[model samples]
Target: MTDTAIQTRQREIASEHLLFKLIEYVEDRHPGLLDFLEQSLDHLGDPADDASKDDAGVRAIAQRMITGARRQGTD
Candidate 1:
């Protein structure tokens, strides 16, 4: 694949991971979170602006995941 294709695929994976984490975090409070996410799947993504800026949304997820891991003593 070309560099652009690889970048786009990586961006899509990162967005999917972030969305998965979000639903996992809120599933207890919102019982239908998974179903909602499945129905509104297109809503998840690293936005075009953020993607242009080097996947800032994914970076944010990395930071949050680190914080959460540290808090739970899993880091």
Candidate 2:
């Protein structure tokens, strides 16, 4: 695969790992958390179209918000 394709696949794999690990950690306590999250996304979502570096500033801000929230371990 090309270098870009490899990197993209790596990012997807890593995202999947993080998502499943999080579900496993809290599924027992919440019981329906997985279903809740899947359902909630229908109400809250970003663009699903192709992105470009032209929006890197907005993307970077969103990334920081997510990473910062993750560090706090709670909303």
Candidate 3:
């Protein structure tokens, strides 16, 4: 595989690991947190079409925000 493909696969693995860990943590400590998050998103209304256009960029921004919030002791 090319270097880019290798790096992309690594990133996908890392993201999946992070997601699993997050769900586990939330389930163990904050019960219903995931449901609340889903509801919050629904409240924002649907943007499925627009989201597909730049989903990666949106996810990257969300990851950064979550990381920053954790670093600041806000989450």
Clashes of each: 0, 0, 0
Per-prediction RMSD in angstroms?
11.7, 11.0, 9.8
Evaluated at residue 16, the lDDT of candidate 3 is 69
- Model 3 C-alpha lDDT per residue in residues 23-64, reported as the tens digit of each score: 657655776654555444423433477535655565555555
For model 3, the superposed segments whose C-alpha errors exceed 4 Å read: 43-75
Q: Could you give the candidate ranking by TM-score, starting with the highest?
A: 2, 3, 1
Candidate 3 clashing pairs, residues 3+ apart or interchain: none
lDDT string for model 1 (1-75, tens) is 999999999999898667656656676556665455445434445656633654546555555654453344311
TM-score of 1: 0.43
Local error of candidate 2 at 27, Å? 0.9
Candidate 2: Cα lDDT at 12? 82
Task: In model 1, state the lDDT of residue 2.
Answer: 100
> Taking the tens digit of each residue's C-alpha lDDT, what string does model 2 give over 1-75?
999999999998898668655755676556666456544443453444656433545555445544443444422
- The lDDT of each candidate is 0.58, 0.57, 0.58
Candidate 1 yields a Cα-based lDDT of: 0.58
